[model samples]
Every structure is written in structure tokens, then in C-alpha cells.
Target: MKTLPILLSCWLLLSSCGNNSQPAADTAATTTPDKPAPAKAASKPTILFFGNSITAGLGVDPEQAFPALVGQKIDSAGLGYMVVNAGLSGETTAGGRSRVGWVLRKPVAVFVLELGGNDGLRGLPLTDTRRNLQAIIDTVRQLSPQAKIVLAGMQIPPNLGADYAAQFKQLYGELAQKNKLTLIPFLLEGVGGVAKFNQRDGIHPTPEGHRLVARTVWAVLQPLLRQPMAQAQ
Candidate 1:
């Protein structure tokens, strides 16, 4: 796939990058009832997109983020689901493990776990990344037994070693099979490694890139939503 070259470039840039500041949560729908709105809107089910910079829509308008685009598709289809962008920039699986509970304070019908990309990018221990991700999955299962979990798979260049890169790419499938979760094989399918789709950083997707991402995610998510929650478990 074109993922290797793109991610190799990303690794080079990220190696020299040191900032890890996190921004506020970006939600596609209003979670609070404080605003003036119809009761029906307030009671919609939530689809939480939790991940790092890509999920945060870095370098693009918030509305152009893939999660927001998914939210729009959900609305257009009258799916009656709210999309919550709980993505935090520069977050690793360890960080996600530490904060997932807080982000799950509200009820969520569909929980899309998009983390671990940073862990892979940094070439951290695959075991630790696996453990942290498992912890996050367990937490969601414990807290929301009926919620359907969706795993967003990510890949990295072999700069860290071919074996490591292969294992990292395989991690998501392993988790999904073990947990009976829905899987988005590759979150950046058509967008990754494409110059026009990526920003100058060669990492985060452009607005148009997010559009393709939204479609990739929606393809997996839409079918999952149609299935019975019990079946998804």
C-alpha cells in the first residue's frame, strides 16, 4: 500500500516534533441539554470518535473533520445518532487509556476507538500499545456493556523494522477478533500517501482527505449500526 511511504515521511517530520499540547474536545453534536433544542435531538444516541490528531482534524476546519462528516451523513440518513469527536491531538494509547473513562462520562451507543497511531508512529513497545488498547476496550465493555465497539486500524512505515510494522498493523485485527468488534481495516485507505490529500506536514489529512476517510469509516460503521447490538457483541 502507499501507507509506508507516506508514514515514512510522517515519521521523519514527527521525529523532530516535540509539542504535545492537547486541545479541547470537539463534538459533532451538542452533548449538553442546556441549549435550546427539541427534546428528540437531545435524546439521540451518540457515536464517539476517539483518537489523535487525525481524528481532531488537525490543519483543517473542525466541521471538515471525518467525524463531523460522519455526523452529517448520519443526519442525512436520519440515523438518529449523535457524533462526538473526543479526539485529542498528539495523544498516544497510554494517554487514551488514562482519559477514556472521563470521555465516557456520557452514554454512547457506538464507540469508535481510533487510537494507537501515535504509539506506532513513535515506535513504542508493541506490547505496551497492545496492553493500553486492551485496557481501553475493557473499560468500554465494563462501562457500556451494550455498546458496539469499532476499531480503526492504522499502519506505519518499516523505519521501525519490518516485523514491528507488520505486528503493529496486525494488532487491530487481533483485537477485533478477540473482542468481536467491528473493524475499519485502514482508516486512511485512499487518503494516505496521496500528496493532495495530506497537508504540508505529510501527516494529517486535508479537508478533502477527511471526506474520503469519512466514507471509509461510514462503510464499516453504517452496517454495524444496522446490526443488532447483541449480534455485534
Candidate 2:
């Protein structure tokens, strides 16, 4: 994730796109001026994509975000699952930790945790980041014991210093191993630092970049999708 100002500016740019696809229902917070209505229970299982602006589709139409693209892939493949993009712009691990419980208010078949980029960007302490992430994981497990989780690993520029960068990169692998979770080693595998794949800001992905990201996420997500629901627990 980029700085707040950069993300806000990018959001403004993307939000101006007249044809932006509607965000997934689960992520949209709506209210009626009259008496509040009760939420209807979901008819289908949900694959919750939890993350920051990247997952929020910062510089592109909402439909172009990888999570929404993955949703399209699911529909094309005839998978009867709903995709919930719970991405909030400029979110850090601590922020995610605090909000995950509310986000998990419904049953989730799969939880895709894509966070920590902002923490890394802000040069937050590694220990605090790990702790907050672990707390989020623990909350998910506690709230939805049977839900399968996929962790999206992120990286920051080496300008932070090699040791710090290397440790940050390794942290995901260790967490995935310890938690026995499916891990996407690098969320930006083929697109990071690639001029053509990113927006002019060089942090967020472009429409094409989101497609590549969808493929990366799909590689791991597809298997989990194919697994029998009862067997995944």
C-alpha cells in the first residue's frame, strides 16, 4: 500500500471512472434514513477477500480488482460461492485486526487475508505487525473454525534496508507454515516494479496488473475451491 495521500489521490482518480463495476454487496455499508432493516442471511457461501487499497482496487474500477476478477472466475467456473471484498484503503495490520471481527459477522467458506503492506510501507515494527496479524488470524479461527484461510504475502522496497526487507518477506512464509495455511508467496509475483503493469504511482496495479494478480491468487484459490466443503475443515 502507498501513503494515505497517494492512496486518497489514486482513489479519487479511479472513483471517477463512470463505468466502475459495483462493489460486492458484503463490503458495502448502507443505511436507510428510516428504521434500519435487518440483513438477509447469505444464500451462498462467501470467499472473503480482506485487505487494503490494492484489494480495494485503488486505481482501477472496482470490477478490475483481483478479488472481483476472481469472483468472475468463480462464476465462469460454475463455483457456487460469493466473493466478499472486505478491502479498506490504507489499512494496516493493526487496523485489520481491529475490524476483522465485524467483517466476520457472517459465515465465510474461505478467508483471503491480504494485509500488512501499509505497515511495511510505514516502516512499522516487525513484531507489532506480526502480533496484529496473528491476532487477526486467531480471531478468524475463533469466529469461524471451519473456514479455510489464504494468506497473501506482500513485499516492500529494499530501501528499508536489506535485513528488514528480508525479514518482512520471510515473515509470511513462517506464518503460513506455522498456521498450516495456504500462502501466496508473493501477491505481486509478475507485476511488481513492472512499469506497464502498474499505475503511474508505481505502487498500485493497473487493470492488466489486476488480471495478473487474479491469476496468482487463482493458482492457490482454485484448489481450495475444488475441495469439498466438509473436507476443508
Candidate 3:
């Protein structure tokens, strides 16, 4: 009778231990840790530079172009924007209008338009040039409604006659006023008449000249970039 009681006590002790372990195992199985929250998608804003040979950096290294230089400034300043240099040599306002839709395939936070110089050089009718520029703007607005626009004003040599030159320069202001956009009056400001800044052809700017142009663009562009990336739209 004594041995039976001891065996019963031992059995009860083991059963109690097993019952305690079972609850712990059950709790572990039933109560899993909560899943971590999903990560947010990265949103990098794109600054698209749309223009002609000046933007293309003709007669100079493409990297030395004002647009690319602007990109360098953006990187240096930690602005964290993607700069798309969509400049094409020999592109006129009409040409830009035709290709703008294709270029704006992706989202754009800022749109820098630098065209109409070729139109002026070729003596194309100002009305046609204006219409083409307006069309390009319309296309940009349609595709990227939230994008900020910067109009690059251009000037032609006095050979086109003072009246024509005056009208050409005035057109950019008119466009900016009408569209309520930012304007960079005279893209080739200091480099235009300066012999050292321009190439042998007396047209396209040299690499050093491009630096000045980049500075000019950066002046207006830096302010826009100061806004948070989420607020760029």
C-alpha cells in the first residue's frame, strides 16, 4: 500500500508537469506575432528638361550641357531629383510639339521648356511658333497636370532685324504670362555676345559658358527643389 501511494504521487507530478508544458505550447502556437507594416513605395520626382541644341550642349560634351550641369547641381545639393535632358539638336518649337507626348511618358515634377530659337533663326512665322509652343504646353499639361513649368526665353542675332528680334524676345514673356509659368529671360544672356564664351561659330556656348548657364538655371530651380519631394506636385 505504501509503494502504490508513492507511484500514484509520481504519476500525478508528471501529469501536472505535462499539463503545464501543454498550455505553454498551445499559447505559443495560437498567438503568433503581428505582421510588420508594409513599407511605403519610393517616390522620386523627375525634372524634365525639354529644349533644343542649347540644351543638347551642341559643340560641347553632353555632360557639359546646361541641363546636365543642372543635374550635377541637384546631386551636389542633395535635392534627389532625376533630371531628364530631352534636348535634341535642330529641334524647333514645331518639332518639340510633335515629340512632347512621347517624352512625357513618365511623370514629371518640373518641365523646363527651351525652344523657339530655331524657329526664330529660320525666320518661321511667329504665329506658327507661338501656336507650336502653346501646343507643347497643352500636351505637357494634359499628360502631367501637376507639373511646374519653366519657360526659357531666347534671343536671336540682330541680323533678324531689331523688330523681329524684339518680337521674338517678347514672345517668351507673353507665353509665361498667359500660362502663369516661370520664365528665365534670355537663356544665353551673358554668353550670347561674348566671343570667349561662345564657340567658333559664334552660336553655341562653350563648356565654360555652360557653367554660367547652369548657374542661371539653378537660381530659379533651387527654389522649386526646396519643397519636399512629396509636395513637388
Candidate order, lDDT descending: 2, 1, 3
Q: What digit string (tens of lDDT, one per residue) describes model 1 on residues 144-224?
A: 777899999998878899999999999999999999888999999988889999999888999899999999999999888
User: Each candidate's TM vs. the true structure?
Assistant: 0.83, 0.83, 0.80
Better of 2 and 3 by TM-score: 2
Residue 232, model 3, lDDT: 70
Per-residue lDDT tens digits of candidate 3, residues 50-96?
88989888998667788878877887787766566788899999899
Model 3 / residue 97 / CA error / Å: 0.5
* Top candidate (lDDT): 2
- Candidate 3 TM-score versus the reference: 0.80
Per-candidate Cα lDDT values, in order, are 0.77, 0.79, 0.76
**Candidate 3 RMSD computed on C-alpha atoms after optimal superposition onto the true structure:** 22.4
Clashes of 1: 0
In angstroms, the error of model 3 at 34 is 34
